[model samples]
Target: MARWEPHARQRLADAALELFAERGYEETTVLDIARRAGLAKSTFFRHFQDKRGVLFAEDAPAGPLVAAIAAAPAQAGPLDAVEYGLDALGRDVFTADRRPFTLRRRAVIEAHPDLREREALKEAGLTAAMGRAIAGRGVPGLAARVTAELGGLALKAAYERWSDPAGTEDFGDIARQTLDEIRSAVAEVRG
Candidate 1:
């Protein structure tokens, strides 16, 4: 086995994204990504299962965001907890420097139907994960499920806005704004 190199996964992900953007996701091969990363094919396999896996690797933000939600103050409501989690993730994971790479990745995923399906599945998984996490905090099952679904919607909306080139707001701000919009919509429907 090749000696494990620190930041190897990130290096491969960066290279893969760059290649995916330049040559298109379908045109880029694993070997091309490995070569760009200055690593062997085996190294690429060790980090990611395949070319698509490189785009959907374990570095997903959902896990940490769920953990943050679980750690929110006990007095916080479900949406409040979700907002806290989004803020935590935005601060810790989606830093300003990562915006360009994120936009590029989104563009690649958007251009490909298969990748879009994968992205939807990933979002569903995140919703389920968030639901489970919220339920674990003693929230009722139905309420937790609804809250999680709403949070997922807010996250998607926020991410879409954040990925826009002309958008100036950060992820956390966008997420909060989206969540508020959701709340207002729900209230209007109830009234």
Candidate 2:
């Protein structure tokens, strides 16, 4: 019988991301992903419910950003937590052993307008949740929302850098650098 273990699920994610890049999302099928992962069709079903689930797998670091933000130091300002939460994803998945594959995933999404919108929607949800979390920590809603949106913007810029094959900086480093730039810009505006 096909299993629904983490390794099997990861295999499904890898296969799905790879095939989505190579064959295009609409052109690819769950069977193709299962075959690429060296698993059975039932194995794929055992993990993800459908082809799209492969894209929105619960295990991706993107899904953890809110939790990380919520768990950061209570004294940490909203923006600081936002930066920390986003930075937490750098070496684990988005920029880890799967960096190249992650880039491919990004490229494919870039080509599909609907996918791009979906991505934006996903980010917005994360941002809204983060904003609410920050507000709960005593940050004003407006400031918390700005912090969340700024974090999302930083994520976008960092992903762009990460997806560029010619870009050599580590994703975490790039994110920190971008955060520094944002800080400087904010300080300049306030001064």
Candidate 3:
């Protein structure tokens, strides 16, 4: 058996996505993913808990996001902090090179009910984390929660636009634009 190698986690994820696309998520197995990645099955287990985990491995977005929010200027509003955090994500996690993989992964998740449910749970968890991060910055709890939800909505909408095959805009740019659009729509609704 080949020992674990560097980039094992990424390899496993890539392999899993390829297999899920080709064979369908329900038909793919952890072992098959391992084999396709040219890594040992143990390597897969070390990186992910199970088949479902392969797709969700990179879902942990709280650290960079929270840190960015915390690092924002002291006078920044909740939404401004969210924009800072999302910009950080764009710089660190959702760079241009990651676009192809992200698009593929999104398609795979959308095609399956189980994966879609998991994606929703991940989104909720991320939103809650963002709320806590914003609240920690001295924003009111309700306001922080609202900002986080708005940020989540912007993130989703931005991702949809950013993942388009013809889209060349940076993730941060799209996110900022989407958030602004949402903000405008909210104001109109209230007026």
Cα lDDT tens digits for candidate 3, 46-86: 88999988778765677888899989999998999999999
Candidate 2 vs 3: which has more TM-score: 3
lDDT of 1 by residue, 1-191 (tens): 35767788888888999999898988999999999988889988987899988767745788789889999999999999999989977898777877877887898899999999999999999899889989988999899999999999988888899989998788899899999999999998886
The residue-by-residue lDDT of candidate 2 on 1-191, one tens digit each, is 44435589877888888888777899999889989988998888977889877665644555567667778887897778877777777756565566766676677778889878988887777667777767767888688878877887877778787768888777888887887788888788885
Q: Model 1: residues >4 Å from true position, as ranges?
A: 1-8
TM-score of 2: 0.81
lDDT of each: 0.88, 0.76, 0.88
User: Could you give the candidate ranking by lDDT, starting with the highest?
Assistant: 3, 1, 2
Off-target runs (Cα >4 Å) in candidate 3 are: 1-4
For this target, which candidate reaches the highest TM-score against the unseen true structure? 3
Which residue pairs in model 3 clash with each other? none
